[model samples]
Target: MTPFEPDRSEDLLNRLKQDDKQAYEKIYFTFSKELLYAAYKKTGDRVIAEELVQNIFISLWEKRQDLQINNLQAYLFGALKLSVINHIRSLVMENKYMEYQMLTYSENHQDTANLVDLHDLSSIIEEGINSLPEKTQEVFRLSRYQHQSTKDIATGLNITEKAVEYHITRSIKRIKEYIKNFYIFL
Candidate 1:
């Protein structure tokens, strides 16, 4: 109720663990919008922000039975920070891909500035993407390169959205694995 209400967060959390709707609603009302805003600030995409917030709440609920909270705000802020960091990391990888694409575009006209380095990097990345399963590679290109929505891709490919999602997820996992293996040499 009030800001100074002592142990109120704990009580609400306890009630939430007991599957109390009113307590859950209260917690949602008190924190959801702010958390969404924080996630949106980091992601700069409403869809991703909504997913991030939903996941945070779902994870919180799953851990509720054994959850401990010394400071609700601190715990929330920490989660937000981790979500933001993951968002930034994805953005970086996306940007790197965009850079490669732009380089390819410029190559058609004879622009060769930093050509060797760009070619080497692009070759490595291409090998990584190529090593993925054909479905994963197609899904990754459609989603990451062509910037198509999952629904659109699934529709265009005449496949189920869940299958498209699975392919994309597999591609991401393979990419991470590639990066890990490549990093070992460095």
Candidate 2:
């Protein structure tokens, strides 16, 4: 592939800002492969790398009018870096939640029937939690599993108490809805 000329890149950016599909397509075709490669190198997962690259392009299109990108390559790479970091952080949190659940279940349950029921319920709850948005999942795990207070979560996450409360409430509502839907399907 030929390198994008500085003048051509500026023109493409201008056309992209005006919602030109061809310009967007050109940008995607130009940078997507490299972005995917970088993401894959960082994540070691082809599916996740492709997803992250796709999200970056989608965001670029969605926010074209509002973006002020003097260096598109740098911006895209930076976004990829942050996305990988967030993904890793999310995986860590999920592993912690699973470990906590396993410990709690093993320590408290002895009867076979109780164990079966608990396993089913735990699976349902885990699915519900996984369906939540990343920040909400984090907030819910911190609040419920770690037993952190709202104030503490807010402080730790660098958000206001109100935001922490909002996330907790939203997570609970969504998880309840998920559980309800799951039972209805059963």
Give lDDT tens digits, candidate 2, residues 1-186. 235577878888999999999999899889989999999999999867866777677778889999988777777789888989987986896588666657666554635645775687788889888988899999999999999998999999999885786677667667766665654564
In model 1, which residue pairs have backbone atoms overlapping below 3 Å? Answer: none
Candidate of highest lDDT: 2
lDDT of 1 by residue, 1-186 (tens): 125243988888789789887876677678778888888887889877866676566567668778787767667668878977887886787688667757765664435644754675577677888998887888889999999999999998899885786676556656766665654553
TM-scores for candidates 1 onward, in order: 0.50, 0.58
Model 1 spans > 4 angstroms off: 1-4, 98-186
Clashing pairs for predicted structure model 2, backbone only: none
Which candidate's TM-score is highest? Answer: 2
RMSD of each: 7.7, 14.8
